[model samples]
Target: MDRTELFLAIIAYTLIVQTFGGKAEGAMLPLFVLLFALPIYVVVHLYRNPSLE
Candidate 1:
């Protein structure tokens, strides 16, 4: 339920959906958004809260 765990869960879910759903083409946009957004969120969060890092 912590941030790291939540992040990992999101990654795992995305991979599972992409792999098992057999619709990579359709899922690409969402997958890409998740992949890109997560890192950006982390970076902005860290930048805003240096104490967290």
Candidate 2:
């Protein structure tokens, strides 16, 4: 498995989940946008690029 990606996914998932956990109480939208965008970009990249290896 991709360790770095796994680590980041877990971290991002935790952050996103936590932020939305309590009705998004005190959630930072700018930061959330950034974090939320990253995974989407990565997913798009992977799908578009295919397994180059």
Best by TM-score: 1
TM-scores for all candidates: the values are: 0.52, 0.42
Tell me how far the alpha carbon of residue 43 in candidate 2 is from the true structure, in angstroms, after superposition. Answer: 0.3
| Each model's Cα RMSD | 2.6, 6.1
Task: List candidate 2 segments past 4 Å from native.
Answer: 1-27
Where is the poorest 10-residue window by lDDT in model 2? 24-33
Across 1-53, the per-residue lDDT of candidate 1 in tens digits comes to: 89678767767777777889976666566557777988999889889898863
- Cα deviation at 51, candidate 1, in Å, is 1.5
Query: How close to the true structure is residue 8 of candidate 1, measured as C-alpha lDDT?
Result: 73
User: Where in model 1 is the C-alpha error above 4 Å?
Assistant: 1-24
- Local distance difference test scores for all models: 0.76, 0.69
